[model samples]
Target: MPFKTKILFLCTGNSCRSQMAEGFARALRSGDMEAYSAGVVRHGMNPLAVKAMAEAGVDISGQSSKTVDDLATKEFDWIITLCGHANENCPYFPGKARRIHAGFDDPPALAKAAATEEEALAHYRRVRDEIKAFVQGFDINAAG
Candidate 1:
């Protein structure tokens, strides 16, 4: 049998980017990658993220927002941070878990400049697609 890489996607909050990455990894790389996501601090799930992902045919609505502490016993092969904040303050993990940064824009923060609801959601959609591309092209050997 082939080995599956256990991956953890992290960010400042469990609300958007990291959640989206987790959803995409599960939907696209379930065979090779075991994916989980968490935050340095919990900020609850973002509805806009769910809506954006639903449009992309990936449902992230059922995923919850949580902190790294929630995953105390779980170990990872790769710890990927989706924001500068989480990368700067990432916790120490035991064993051979390698940490990497894959930062993406904060959708809510970007949406602050939007003029309308659709415009705001555009930010979510764009970031969702960007994250999808990143997750889809993730090269395990390169990281390993």
Candidate 2:
């Protein structure tokens, strides 16, 4: 059997973007990759993120918000940063992990100034679909 690539998605908070990426990666590339997500700081899983994934038939409610420190001992084939903050502040990984920057807009931040819940959720949904598309088209073989 071919070995599955392990990937870690990082963000400032393990709330929206990173969580969405992990969910899509797992749902779309389970046979070729193992997906995990963490943040520089844990902000807990975003409810809107969970809701957005469910809309696309991927359930991410079981996933937890974790920190880079929590996965210190784990090794990954790739570490993808989903936000500028995480790309700048990512911790060292003691392995052959290749780092990639694929920054996505922060849904929570965009939603913060939203005038209504629907407007706020729109931000989450947009980012969620973007992340899903990125994950669906990820070049896992190139990581090798």
Q: In terms of lDDT, which candidate is strongest?
A: 1
User: In order, what is each prediction's RMSD in angstroms?
Assistant: 1.1, 1.3
- As a TM-score, model 2 comes out at 0.95
Worst 10 residues of 2 by lDDT: 135-144
lDDT string for model 2 (1-144, tens) is 879899999999898888899988888899999999999999998998898789889999999999999999899999999999999999999988999999899988999999988899899989888898889888975753
C-alpha displacement of 20 in model 1, angstroms? 0.2
Q: On residues 22-120, what C-alpha lDDT tens digit does candidate 1 reach at each position?
A: 999999999999999999999999998999999999999999999999998998999999999999999998988988898899999999989998999
**TM-score, each model?**
0.96, 0.95
* Runs in model 2 lying further than 4 Å from the true structure: none
Q: Which 10 successive residues of model 1 have the least lDDT summed?
A: 135-144
Instruction: Give the RMSD in angstroms, all C-alphas superposed, for model 1.
Output: 1.1
